[model samples]
Target: MPGIEAGGIAVVLVARSAIAAAPRAEMERLAGQVSGLHEIALATYAFTEQGQPALREVVANLRRRPFREIRLVPLLFPMEASFRAWIGRTLARWQLEWDTEGPAIRIGPGPNASERLTDLVSDLVETAGREKPFMPAEHPATTGSVVAAAHRRVLVCQGGPCNEAGAAAIWGHLRNEQEGQSLRTAGSGMMSATTSCLGPCSLAPVVQVWPEGTVYGGVNEAGIDAIIREHLLGDRPVESLAYPANGRKQALRLRE
Candidate 1:
């Protein structure tokens, strides 16, 4: 099927020529399994060094294509200095160009294994299931459960960056929102708590989900409200509340 016409959204991957090539190919394969992708482009540079050349190339190409909006997924992981620095400078440049020129570019996160990689696994299952349909029940657990059947936890990062970024406000908001209002998932209500830095300092004020081990970055006041109401109460991820980090995608597995 033809890719989704996301109005003006273009999916641009910032990766070195070699590194991004494989992941981009994988993303394409994986994306084929899913629907609603913005138009895609791979930036030709390494994240270890300045990406000015590649950034210019990408921006030029994008200008020619004229996407009304842009979503950048850095092909790196862990929100290191490289990804952190790039996000600030590059986004500002793009924003300025859009205002002065045309076609604004919006941004989002990398392809974390959880949200953007199911397509790869699904495709594999499809290709290999010709002889016998793959079934989860038939395959016994290789290891014990990563999460307790009924465990409740809320890990809030109180490290310097997170605190300075206003995690305190978020903490209070979640508390007020969750109080009196009981939430139960699997079996027990979520036990709210806090912790040290999650290390996505550039994004600041990161929140990690336990048992599931999902991390959300770039959170603030309104974000706290939606997260509490949706994820905490409904036991689902609030996609709109999450911002892109170092890479387009990496999965922090609950278990090894």
Candidate 2:
């Protein structure tokens, strides 16, 4: 992004998706500040399946446009130690996936923008001694004894085995699917949580549904859709994909 040309440049504000993240409007405000860019977008590394677009998806779409270059502004700070390197490798992956001709891809904001962010951080740190008091009414942690009206509870295994077997991707897909099906709403009667393990470690990427306690094995994007649409929303477990191992057949029998 040299010579300071105005048009033909696309800027993307990229971050890793997280649960209950800060407002998208805040990021939009930042993107709007810069002028003369061909296009500006927001993308994430697919931590959650919310309103954010995947980095790969956004890059691909921007490449279709006649922009001279695509710039990815990393919005995530305090990321994992390997995050910067990971971003490089991810861009490499995108290049390999789409081998056709496209604009040059570069990561990070220009120096002036980076300096502004640095100054903002410095100002915040200069006043870091003042602590904001927590408000319990705004963010209550504990609930009363009243029983939940939810009809089903889903537990996605995050055990060591499952994590190695793609539990993170599964969780992301599940989040998107849950949102698509409107299952996360308070009145949806559907609840979901992450669990350490669900037994049947043989079925490493397991998803368990409550009431009947049916454990699903080898879940993927399609499996998540089936679990939400056919199982939770349809009131029936996807039996074919269900792995009733480790004595859980008894719990599944309750449904019969």
Each model's TM-score, in the order given?
Answer: 0.35, 0.58
Error of 1 at 195 (Å): 0.7
The lowest-lDDT stretch of 10 consecutive residues in candidate 1 is 42-51
Stretches of candidate 2 off by over 4 Å are 1-11, 16-22, 33-74, 81-121, 127-147, 160-166, 184-188, 199-204, 247-256
Candidate 2 lDDT tens digits, 1-256: 4244333677777655644546566665666775434344322232322345555567778778677787777666654434445456546645765788788888774233464778877888877757686556877668668565788888889887666665655676676657666786533477777899877666667899888888888775567888887887778789867866555443222221
Best candidate (score: TM-score): 2
- lDDT per residue for candidate 1 within 48-99, as digits (tens), equals 1222223444555665554556555566544444344445554464455456
Residue 116, candidate 1: Cα error in Å is 60
